[model samples]
Target chain A: MKFRSMLAALAVLVLGAAQAQEPIRIGSFLAVTGGAAFLGDPEQKTLELYVERLNAAGGVLGRKLQLIVYDSAGDAEKARTFAKRLIEQDKVDVIVGGSTTGETMAMVPLVEAAGVPFISLAGAVVIVEPVKKWVFKTPHSDRQACERIFVDMKARGATKVALISGAGGFDKSMRAQCLQVAKNHGIEIVADEAYGTGDTDMTAQLTKIKNTPGVQAVLNVGFGQSPAIVTKNHKQLGISQPLYQSHGVASKAFIKLAGDAAEGVRLPAAALLVAETLPDSDPQKKVVLGYKREYEARFKSEISTFGGHAWDGLMLAVEAIRKAGSTDKAKVRDALESIRGFVGIDGVFNMSATDHVGLDISGLRMLEIRKGDWTLVK
Target chain B: MSGRTASLATLAGIVLLLPLALQNNYYYEVAIQVGLNAIVCVGLNLLIGYAGQISLGHAGFFGLGAYGSAILTARYGWPPLAALASATAGVAVLAYLIGRPILRLRGHYLAMATLGMGIIISIVIATEDRLTGGPDGMPVPALAAFGAALSGERVWYWVVGATLLAAVWLALNLVDSPHGRALRALHGSEVGAEVTGIDSARHKVKVFVISAVYAALAGSLTAHYAGFVTPAKVTFFHSIELVTMVVFGGMASTFGAVVGAAVLTVLPQALTVFKEYEMVVFGAVMMLTMIFMPRGLVPTLALTLSGRRLPR
Candidate 1:
């Protein structure tokens, strides 16, 4: 039996060698530097590292992966231009990576027109709302984050809430989405307050939320350092009501920045953060642990869910290419849409003709900061 | 050919021949961006290079033009061309009003004033979520004529290329005119220009308005071309980049401004192959160029080609 299995493995390797050919070109444009670097930097690293690993493991469809990344620095025009370069000049078979909704939306027309498959890592509903044929994304939209938070709120019996958001693009978009869906979620936004970008403190806004009567929970709908400051201020003001944050602050840096203030704060994030704690029976355990181990061992940095989005994006493109058995753009696009129950770092995606994002609010696991680390909330 | 005709012919030749060198849509996209930046830099050259005045808020006027055209065509349902014209005209009037008062502040004070103005405009665009779409920005209606949308990189290359040539011709003529000499006179010394019946204040305001108009027109064209506009274009960093292009290409030289815009526009795209070290290499290149050719790219090269000895 051992000898028979060895022979089978040798036969498969030989067949794979025969099928292997040129590298399957994957072009990506990300905001790898400048203002949105937090999102783009990790994403770039994930793509580069995994593509190298896949190539070493005999690649997808016996063809190696070639990833060419351009940093757009969150500039929309540059993103559009880079998309053109990726399509027209690089002649990439598949494209993935857009770190901001503005960048993703800017490239939407060009990719759709050129008949290229693009999977974005940005967060926004507009990219897939009308459901353009060629355009898709990996990151859960801001609406999904809002809905997931509301589910937790509903479970906790929180009816009245106060919304405090920062004046950044993601912050405002998430704030708007939460407001749009609040009534449906059975949550009432009693007080709505905002702060300017680069504001050192958010205590004044926290004070107002605290003063608002019957405010059962205070939701901070923002990302980056602002949310951290919001968390810190919520603790500073000693408001005991549950303080929930958006998926924007899912990274470990949030806990480090907010420190002890982050305790008991709940936000929606991927299960990859608590990979070690996940049961072996969990479907995501294998892939999540593999990704977390590879990234941590290689980069020596704490993993961010932003990087997980890129991992899902690259792997999805690879799987579609494998399913199509060729680099044919249309076939690969169809394969991507038809992919069902494919577990990824983000979620178990089941893409369809109408729903390109695939992962719903359920994909985003509710995680709470406990003892300065993410603890999966049951 | 005369100096004016020679420079214009050289610019026209390159613009005509650029398409052949462009292999595909990607090349055309980069070329289009270069042309747009060149047009704005030409106007900026007139202000900083020839007139010796400074504007750190130049991008504010550019942003206002973009947002103005975007809102008018997309939100109000006006025609694209009409929106572009109105936006440019509005910015010109605004610039005139602003220039009359702020032009009086000489040197660093004027710089500070313009910088503050730019910050204010950026903030307004970022905060005015109802109209400007806040920091996330808004999609713009494409420039169309007679029902056909004027889209695609190939078509835009010619449009922008032709517009750039026309702008150069106008600038070349204006620079050689008495008004041009008046600008130079004021650049030398405001009191000296006024003593010679140059009406330094009037000339300063006129050139400022003209430059602002140029920036506004380019901004509107950019909005329509890309079909998107963000407050990112209106930021202080953008203003600094524009100024750097004017200075880097060689102030007071039209061809230099075009070269600076072209090289800088293409540099970042070309440097992507460097991967992790792209920014470091980019910064190093800029530093070396400034150190080696202190007079900027064009003037230094022009001086050498003419076999002129160094003054010092």
Candidate 2:
């Protein structure tokens, strides 16, 4: 009896060791439980979608992909620590997805040292700039968004514009780029103002922008209540000039929060949210509609650019793994760089090592809220 | 030896050996943060413990210092060390100006005033995108001193440790001096201390300004070390966290502040195993600690170990 028990114990130990070595784990650090839950909850769903789809098509290198996610509450320092733990302890094959640029950059050093591919969802050029081989991004960079907004603004005849943005990661970069883009395009930015995360009133800044001479339009950047602030306050102050919002405010939440004031607010958005507005014959239309149907059916919530970012990040990572035919970071990164004509929910992705930003201005469609409904303006 | 002296000696020895002992970059990172928290809490303890004043808006000073340094370095191309000095000086001036009127109020009024200061700073930091980089806060110029940039966890650990040690030593010296005693006397009974010839209002304002400088210096160090600063660093939440460390460690004891900061910092990391439940457990522990041992972890633990319960 004692001999039999010893043999069984040895067998169990062997099984445990083999099971541990079976699969490559991918770590996802998101704001899953914090103020950014509106963003991270969908991020978790997209990650799951990737995992399921990858497994359905025969797992990466015949090894089932394991995903580990942590909630950093959109805190950069916390994200950094979580990234380290994921690399060192969880032993993830790659680190994917971050809620904010601050959180994503915080992971750069650790993931680089750990020799894992880090694909960020945050729209910061710094995330992939001076491009480390191990670091790549799937989101449109802040610079691209800035260029797109200005290009659209100039096209729309918004020459003299006032700028107001929330003092958040994406908005900060976007605002800087907007100013540079304005200088290049000869778009006179009359007034520039800012606000914080939890601010409810932006009357002072909005008032300043309203009072600025020759301000034909307002370029509102940042996320959360800031966009809502511009929307409501602009109407209240009777500043009927054109309002151009950053992609950060391209959300149903913004509309809901801003009430009737959200009407007639033009913003740049990925084609995913308003895919139905595109003709059925459009190739990108089918994939986006499919995601919209599936996402609404499952999550019962409206999709936003934020979720579209997650969808793109997750799908791209899965595609790279499949193309690489292995969980190896080097191979996966090469495959990611080589991605061509990949129709994602966000945009048609064509990534290369030199250009980690898969989608550019072409992929983004101009969206406007007209009478509390999202309409494709261009 | 007095418990304070012994605790200070132990802290000094630990800090001295910390860089050598912690070879891991992760630990170095945590230690660097602990040092930063210790600096903030030590400054906060001056107001809460010695002067018996509360400022819920200390984070405003911290934010101003961080944003001041970040903008100076990033926009003006000022050297980081020079920026740090200028930022600290700027905050000191701002604090004195803001505190002159606000500190006159007592208790909740004072708390509310400080809270307003924090809110105003946050608003300014958030809105002034042209100047402060707005709510996303600006990236700090890397901590460069004498032409070399301070990067990596190991270097930051030493710099922060030395700064924290100096702060503690300064605070310790102040607490031991006649000025500290006068502050303490004022804390115990303002009228009595005034009767005993301590300039109650002057001492309060002085301690308030001193504490603000400490917070500002700590904020500058934090921004330089992290190579970034956001308004979140000086938000009300951060102020509350600093106050928590001071009160949780034993409000009157400077060593208690350090211990509180260290324990709270490490606790969250250790409790990461609980995952989402960690927050719940953290809240529970905090509540229970405050309810049962209001003097804080260090004093309560000391008292227990000495086979004496805290006097009701």
In terms of lDDT, the best-performing candidate is 1
Off by over 4 Å in 2: A1-22, A52-58, A88-91, A105-116, A124-134, A142-172, A175-179, A182-222, A225-245, A254-266, A324-331, A368-372, A375-378, B1-3, B16-23, B146-148
Prediction RMSDs, each to the true structure: 6.4, 5.3
Summarize candidate 2's per-residue lDDT along B1-312 as a digit string, tens digits. 286577778888999876665535666777788888888889899989989999898888888777788888999999988999999998888888887888789999999888988988877786676787554556677888877988887778778888888888888989988999999998889889989999888888888988999899888888777776666676788889889889988887888889889978877876665767989999999999999987898888888999986786
Q: What's model 1's lDDT at A130?
A: 91
The superposed Cα distance between candidate 1 and the true structure at residue A212, in angstroms, equals: 1.8
lDDT of 2 by residue, A96-210 (tens): 8888776876567667767888888878777777777788776677777777777877888888889898766677788777887687877888888887666888888888888
State what share of the real interface contacts each candidate retains: 0.60, 0.19
Write down the lDDT of every candidate, Cα atoms only: 0.90, 0.80
DockQ of each: 0.40, 0.18
**Across residues B193-267, which tens digit of lDDT does each residue of candidate 1 receive?**
888888888999999999999899899999999988888899999999999999889999888899999989988
Instruction: Single out the weakest 10-residue window by summed lDDT for candidate 1 chain A.
Output: A1-10
TM-score per model (chain B): 0.98, 0.95
**DockQ score, prediction 1:** 0.40
